[model samples]
Every structure is written in structure tokens, then in C-alpha cells.
Target: MLNEKKEMPLMVRQSLDQTYDVIRKKSIKKKRTFNPQVIIAIAASACLVVGLGLSNDHVMASINKWLGFDDKGVEQAVNNGMLQEDHHSVTDQGVKIAINDHFSDENKLGLSFQLAFDHPSMLKHVENVSLDYRLKNGDGQYIEEFIPDTKPLKGKNRYTSFFDYQNPLIDEKSGMVQFNTLSDSSEGTIPKLKDAVIEIESINIFDNTGKLKKINGHWNLSLSNNKKAEEMIQYKIQNVSSAIQVLKARSTPTALNIVLSLKGIDKERDEKLPSDMVIVDEAGHEYRIKGLRSVSKNNETIISANFPISSYNQHKKLELMIKGIEKIHLIKQ
Candidate 1:
């Protein structure tokens, strides 16, 4: 057996040695193989971490777009557009404003507001005023209209003037038709005066055809404290005709500051002549008196302050009325 083994050994021994080596390598590979679940879990974890990182970056990019700010590392690829330049300002107590960010270009700012006024020419008789506006991107190109509208504010008082007569004395002093004549026609009512100074509430002028005319042109208005009218002389009305009519029931609680010129003086009387006036709102209660003054030019006068009244309310419209005086120059204090 020993002799036979020796004779056939060389090739067989080489073959057996190669086979052993292959088996050892195979066993080592088997030992090193990972568990299936662990491998699957690790691969999924890596994919999840990568996906989360990408999602965070996307979220940051969206935020940057909304804010219109470039504080973060996210870069905004802004569109190429034009920029517009527009601005306007007014020096009035009745106006206000605000703006937005999408149109990041500061050149054209957006604005909007309202106005309140006491007189017609409050903002320089600006009948039809308008604003032109535009918006653009970072580049200086026009994109959209910023102020898309044009608004207008109007005067509260209407103008009127149309009475026909030859000797119709336009009281250059008061800027109204002289109170010397009364219109007995149907269009207007003239109150019979009981005093020299007539307290006219509101006067409605009429033409020869008895059509209502505008009370435009000049008017004398007065403001006064109530205490002064009480102790003063009361001028009663002697006669009222078509040429001179008094406004009735215009006397308020406050005293009046009379501003009129003596068309014809009856100085032979002991006391100052009373006025041809009536208070439309009063029920036999007389209003107090302050004082009177003739207008500087053309014998016109400005009477003022019959009552010491004040408004605690924030926004009150200021108003005053007078009949004897023909012209008024209204102003704020």
C-alpha cells in the first residue's frame, strides 16, 4: 500500500491542497456576511438622512422667497424687470399713508389716503388732481401701476348770485344785497323786523321773476359772546318794504357783533337805532348782544361772538351766520 501511494501521489496531492484552500476561503466569506435586516435598515437610514438634508434646504429657499430678504444663504434668482420713481407730498392737516414690499424697488413706493376740509379752496382750488405711479423689479423697468387710481375732493359751499334790479345796492361792505329792500314776491320770504339789527337765519335771494337766486358774492357774518347784547341799546325796525326786508328768527343764544354802515342815519333819536332782525329759532326769547363795527372799506362790518360755545368733540365743522352785514372773510384760528 505504501509503494502504490508513493507512485501516484504528486498530482493528487496538488489537487487536494487546492481544494482545501478553496474551502477555507469560502468559510471566511460566510463568517463575514452581514444580517439581511441590518443591511436593509442601514441602507434605508442613509437614504433617509440624505432626503432630510435635501428637504431642509428646500424649506429654507421657500422662506427666503416669502420674506423678500436675502439674509440666508439661499440665493433668489430674481426676474429681470424695470424700476420706477414716483413721490408726492401735501402740507394739509387732513391727510395720511403706507407701503408694501413685493415691489422691492424703492424707486416707486405705493401709497393711499382721505381728506377733510372746512372751505372750498382748502387745497389751493385743486379741482381735478391725479397721481401717476409704477412698480418694477430690481432692474429699472416698469412692471405695474402702483397708484392705480385718481381721486378728487370737492368744496362744501355752493356759489349763487342772480337778482335783477336797477338800484339793487350790492352791499360792497357785506358782499350781499343791501337789506334796505324786501321782496314781496313768492320766491322768497322777508320777515317783518321788530329791531334795527335783523337777525337773519338763512337768506334766499329771488329774481324779478320770483325765481330763487344764488346767495353768492359778499356776506357779513358775526360771532359774539352772549353777555354783551343784554345791556346794549335795542334798535327796533320802523318800516320794511320791497327794497329792505329783514330775515326772521336768526338770533341765537349768543350776542352778535354787528358790522354794518349807516345807510341813512336817524341820529335825532335818543338811543342808537335798533336793527330790523328776527330769530327764526327763538320762541320769544331774545339773544344777548356783544358789540358792532362798520367794515373798514365800503362801510361793511364784521360782527362776531354771540355765544361762548366750544366743542369737546374731536371733529366739529365751524359755522357762522349774519344778515345785517353783507360780506364775510372766513378764517381759522
Candidate 2:
């Protein structure tokens, strides 16, 4: 009876073992030493935070359920401090545009805004609305490879739009990020200026019958880069069969962007290159692929993919899983 009382329960023992394993691996990888007492305290705190005396598997399952790994994932991100809350507004020609919130990282900027029409009748005639926007730096220089993803929510009179813009030239600097056209993509040079002016030349509204109505005005706004908001992690691949390198990863409240470089590609067989990839966290939570783009620069191919993630602050390690890449022949032609 004394010996049995001294033994730890199976679930508790397993949880402690996993906790120790994670701490040991992180300490070794980070080259830091942790006192055993501190480790024990941290383990206890973790267990308490997750649930009183809950197994690791049960804790993760509860977390996954709370995160709602489905359509409500974005709501989970907003609750987890991944998205910024803003109340900026601008009005032009009786149309009010309110910037509600945004998520930004090194590679991309996502803006959520509400558009309210002054007249309810105007909403009926509008089948879609587009912003004609131009982003110029303090020196009037422009950033290159501006790609925009605009999504309009279902509504009348009051509508919401989420705009996602990708800028490879986004650095740790202040600049004006602006837009006003329906949608367009262009290439320009990276701006060196510290600030920028975003000018909206006009707002175009298309009716259900395809008639276009243009509202002409200069709607301008200024934005400064929040360098502290960005979080990036980089890892080097070891003992891999192919020359695939994950250059860096950026995590926002709403999404994760992984930058990769794949070497020795066959230009002739470009279609055979793998386009699908998955990011799995330590708890087996999978972040689905949002979008991907590949560009060739200086004889090297760089790939960038964005994945929507929920509860991103909970995980310490993520695995990048690429599919159907090994079968591709890499003979440069």
C-alpha cells in the first residue's frame, strides 16, 4: 500500500514526461539551462492554466475545441491578440469608410473596413465596389509587386471588406500604404522613404446590369509601420534529400507566412513543382493553405505561402510539410 501510494498515476506521469521532454528539447536547441525546480514550477503552472490535473492530450483537445478549428477561427485569432483594433475613418462624397481592424507582418498587410452608403437606394444599384488606390513613399517612390485580395461581405447599405495586400519590399520602415482602384497588380521599386501617402483616386461602383458609376475624389491617408508588431522565426533544414530551404516564417494573429527557397528547379517542368504545403503545430493542429506565389530572382526560385491559423500564440514549434516535390526532376534547362 505504501509503494502504490508513492507511484504517480499514468495520465499524470505521461503529462509530466511530455512536459519535461518539451522543456529539454527547447533548452538544448536554445542552448539555455533551466533549473529543475523552475521546470517543475513551470510544468505545474502549465497544467493549472490548461486545467486542473488534466492530461496533455485532454488539454490539447480542449484547446482545439475552444479554438473552433473551423469558420470561427478568425474570431479566435481576434480574441488571442493577433489582430489590431482600430477605429480610423474617412469620408468622401457621402460615403463613409471606417477602418475597423488590421493585421500586419513583414510580408503582408490585412485591413478590415466597413463601408456605409449615405443613401440606401445607392446600395441597390451597387453590385460591387472597388477602390482605386496608389501607394507612394515620402519621396514619391513606389514598392514593387503589389498584390491585393479584396473580399466583400454580404450586406446592403452597410457592407464590410477585408483587403489583404502583399508587398515583398515591406521592411522595418514607415511608409504610406494606400489603395483606391477596383483591383490591379503592378511592379515597382522598393521605396527608401520613411513615410508614404496613400491616395485613392476614385471609387467605382458597378451595378447589377454592369453599369459603372465613378466617384471622383482624392482620399488620402498616412500609415506608419509598427515594427514591434511583427514576429518572425527562421530555421535551417538539416539532412534533407532536396535543396529546400525555409528562409523565414512570419506569424500574425490571423495568418502565417512561410518564405521558402527551392533550388535546382527544371524550368521546363514548372508545372510539376509542388504547390500544396501544410503547416502543423506541435499539438497536431493543421493550418490550411490560404495562397501561394513563386517568383524567380537572380536564378533562384522563392516561394511564399500564407496559411490561416487560430490560437497561434499557443505553439512553440511548427513543421512545414511539402507534398509531391520529391518526384520532380531538377535538371536545369
Candidate 3:
């Protein structure tokens, strides 16, 4: 009888080994990793077999039922991370974006961007990202459009000229232009540039966290209230002709007397206009706009304003704008 007892214990031990083999085989076949939960389930199955101490075959059957062997296929035993499971919140993909042009004139724009994703790997596939931005008026007409991927966020990579006007250089000292080269092929025919409300959409496969992992999705963006670009060059007047005409016809016919009343300048006279900066009118006439005589206590620059100008009376639009200079204008009362 004592020998029978020893045999019974031996049978139980053999049965337990068979159960472990079954579980381990199923895990290997499914390519699944066993976590603490699976370990606990295995331990519980062992306890059930010992507590009953049934015949070896009967114990095996009981162990199978306890572990849900019939229902627990390899498919249900695997654990995948959140990203792999395809579950993420909307805010995860929505991130703040900013544009920057470290090498740009005060006028040209530099694009900047920032975004967050459900997974860090999303940042790796940024090559396919696309962004579109437009400035509009209240009527929904566009004022400007920007696409970073189609063209480099900046212009031609050329040095800025100081004295050169309209063509890109403000003066030999202060302004600059830049160009960038890209390897990506053009996606399709370029879109027309028009003034319209801002609209944005894009797709990307980024794995910012690592090269092997990637996040794939499309980005839809629309924004307004962008005040960054507008603040760069304040106080601008498009047509300075109405007043320039009267001054030219009455004054030295060739000279443009721009009575810049520095009084309107928001800053001090010394602070508004700077030394070495000359103000030129449309007549190709050049004169220093900022000097002891030019800046009055009332903050006015009465210096002679002469720049080569067109003689068309109908084109009465004399343009006077600050290029490399600090602050200046034609005084029209």
C-alpha cells in the first residue's frame, strides 16, 4: 500500500510536466511572450491537479479544462503595445507647429513646425510630411500662400544686397536672400498661388523614436490669427505718389521733398532714423533722411528726398518704404 502511495505521487509529478509542456509549446507556436498573468494561470492549473489527485489521464483532462486549453489558442495569449494595437487619442497626433528661417531678411518668411504623436517613432518618417498655409482677409480672399514641402520654406540661397532695391537686396549691409535644394520629386503640377483662407492637409510615415519603428497617418491643419510675420515690418504705405507729385511739381521739378514729420514716429527721433541710412524717392534721388538737421525735436526728417521716379501723372503712386533703414516716410499733411 505504501508503494502504491509513492506511485501516485510519481504519477502526479509526470502529469504536471505534461501540462507545462503543453503551455510552453502553445506559447512558442504563437510567438507570444509570457507575462506574470500567464505564470499565475499555470500555477493554478498545477494546484487543481494535486488537490484532486485523480488518475493521470483524468488529472490531465482537469488541467486542460482549468487552463481553458480548448478556448485559449495562441492568438489570445499575445501582448502588443498601444501603438501596435492601433489605439490612440486625437490629442496625441495634434501638436503645435512653428516655422523659422534663421537666415532670412526681415521680410522673407521662414517656416517652422512642431508636432506630437501617439508614438515617438512617428517623427522618423517626416520626409513625406506636407503643410499648406494661407493668409486671408475678412472676405475670405487670400493674401499669401505657403507650402514647405513643394519648395524650401525659404527662397533662393543668394546673398542679400544692401543698396539693391526690389530685386532682393535692401542694402549692401543689412538684407539677405537664400535658396534651398531638395531631393524629393515633384508630387504633381504645382498649385496656383492666390489669396485665400488657410487650408492644410498632409500624410506621413514617421518613426521619430527609432529607424525600425514607424507611425503612419495623415495631418489636416487649418489656422488663423498668425501675427508673427506681420509684426516684422510695421508701418508700410504702398502708394506715396499723391503727395510726392505735389512736392515735385512745386519744388525742384527733379527733386522730391518728402517732409517726413517724425512726429508720428512711435519712437524718439534719435531712435527712429539711424545714421548712414539714406532715404531715396522714386526719382533715383538719394538723400540722408536721419541726421541732426533731418531730425527735429518734433521728430521730423525734412531732408531732401530724391530717387529716380516715373513721370506718369496717372501712375501717381510714388512708393517710399523702409528697406535697410530703421524708420522713415514722406510727410504728407
Candidate 4:
């Protein structure tokens, strides 16, 4: 194991370990191994930040750069070739709804659309506007729905922007067109989306007339990306017991998430994977990492961590070096 600095109290660390074990055990009983092959990163890790640190199975990405919608994670997903572009459109009530593009992985979907209004002034009276509809899989089942109280959490150390759009606004498209990034209203457990469709029931709007108007339309389009996504290629760790393995490591627009497993917690040095650590890529660029979650099993410990994403995929040969460890190479070059 890599030598470390800054240690959480032994008691607190053990408690966290137990929690992870329970979570991992329940996962073993409830789900099967995930094998998704998509794009981006140097490939040795993505903690699903490698659960491979997964919580949200219903994470829907909403990002549109040309129209000011911003989501770094999904945008990075596009760079990884996960997003698919669709110029398909439908005109209703003088509004042209165009499916700009989308990306999908592990039951989660992200989308961006452009609504070109025939008359730009029509939006002047729009008080509230939204798409009332559902996204269904090939089987016609809703893919995401209401958020249950028990929904998977966006891990504390995970990038907060993640798959969500930041403060998406509908009033600022700068032209006759209005951009929209949709999210979270539909859900399913269908494993993966083979062929899915988003049925737009209506373009619901509230104008200055103090009445809700539904612009019912025939706006249903195909949103199926048959291109398989990036797979979590497990990487290796050096100077650690054979038990330690890089199960997943992934980077969002500006963050890298890594999850690793250690066979047992008997050794004092192996008791924890500290946040006071550094990760170096092929170009000698350095990044510091922090622990997100640690699960300790009777015979193993699973740990997930994160660091800022910068020159990550662009530079190869990623390695993890323990802080204050006299330059020991923790991750293989």
C-alpha cells in the first residue's frame, strides 16, 4: 500500500469500512457486474468513481454550450464520444423542436434540444415553459421518474456538476431559437437503452394570459445510440498487496474519480487510503486526490477517491503517488 499522511481516527475509519462492506454485500445480492465500454480517460479506472462509487442510476445529463447550458461532465462525455448527435426536428405552434444530441450509459440518459420559434417575439410572453413528456425505452416503459428519498447520492467527493446542467435558463438563446436541457423526470431498471424514444406530449407554457396552455404536438423522435460506451478498464497499483486492484477510475470535465480494492485491513498502513495523495500523468503533471468512500469487508476493503481533471486523458501514463512517501511510485507508469 502507498504510504500516507493525515489519518482519520481509527474508530471513524473502521466505521466507514463497515458501512462500505454492507453496501458492497447488498450490491452483490441486488446487482450483477457492470461491463460498459464507452469513451475518454486513460482507461485504467472510472469509479461508476470506479460502486467502480455509483449512486445515481438515474443521472440525466443536460448541457448545451452553443445555447449557454453548461454541464462539464456531460460535455466531457461528448469528447469521449459518448454523446450522439441528432438533427431531427418537428414544428408545432410555430416552434421547431430539434433534437441536438444525446449520450447514454448504464441506464442514465442526457439530452440537449433547440427550439427555433418561427416568431422570436412569441417567447416574450412566455412566463414558464417546459416539455411535458416521458422518455421510454424500446419497450415503451418510462426511463426515469420521481426521485425517491432513497435515490443514490451524489458522493461527497464526486464532482457536484456531474451530469446535471448548472442553472439552465430558457430565456437566453439570443435569437429566434430557445435551448432546453431536460433531466430527471423519467426512470427505469431496464439495464441499458437499446432503442428509446422521447414522446413530447406538449410544450406546456404559461403566458401573460394567466392560463396554462399546452401546445400539443406530434414530436416523437428516435434517440438510440448503438455505439457502445467506454468500459471501466481496471488498472494496476504498485508496491501494494496483490489484493489491491484498480477496479474503476473515471474523469469528468474537471475531476478524476478512482475506486480501488484491498484484500484485508489487518496492516496499519493499509488501514486507510488517505486524501493527502498525488496523481501524476505521463507528462509529469500532478494532481492531488481525496478519498470519497471506503468499505471494509471481513476479507477486503473497497476505496473510492477523486482528484481534479486536468491534462488527464490528453496525457498518458497515469500514476498515483502517496504524499510524503519519499517519491515511491504508487501507480504504474
Write down the worst ten-residue block by lDDT for model 2: 1-10
Ranking by TM-score: 2, 4, 3, 1
**Candidate 4 lDDT by residue in tens digits, 75-188:** 455566666777678777678776767765432345666565666565564433445445566865556421112233222221111122211123323323333442311111
Better of 2 and 3 by TM-score: 2
What TM-score does candidate 2 reach?
Answer: 0.52
Q: Higher TM-score: candidate 1 or 2?
A: 2
Task: Give the per-residue lDDT digits (tens) of candidate 2, residues 29-91.
Answer: 422223331011111101112212212223222322112222233444546554544556677
lDDT score for residue 253 of model 1: 17
Highest-TM-score candidate: 2
lDDT by residue (1-333, candidate 1, tens digit) is 000000000111122233223223322331111222100101100000111111222232232121121111001112211111111222222221111111111111111111122232322311111112222222323222212123121222211111101111221212211111100111111111111111121223333232332222211111111121111122223333332222211111112222233333333220221232222211233322211111223432222212211111111222222344232221222
TM-score of each: 0.15, 0.52, 0.22, 0.46
RMSD of each: 46.2, 21.2, 32.6, 15.1
Model 1 Cα RMSD, 1 decimal: 46.2
Task: State the local distance difference test value for candidate 1.
Answer: 0.19
Best-fitting candidate, measured by lDDT?
Answer: 4
Descending-lDDT candidate ranking: 4, 2, 3, 1
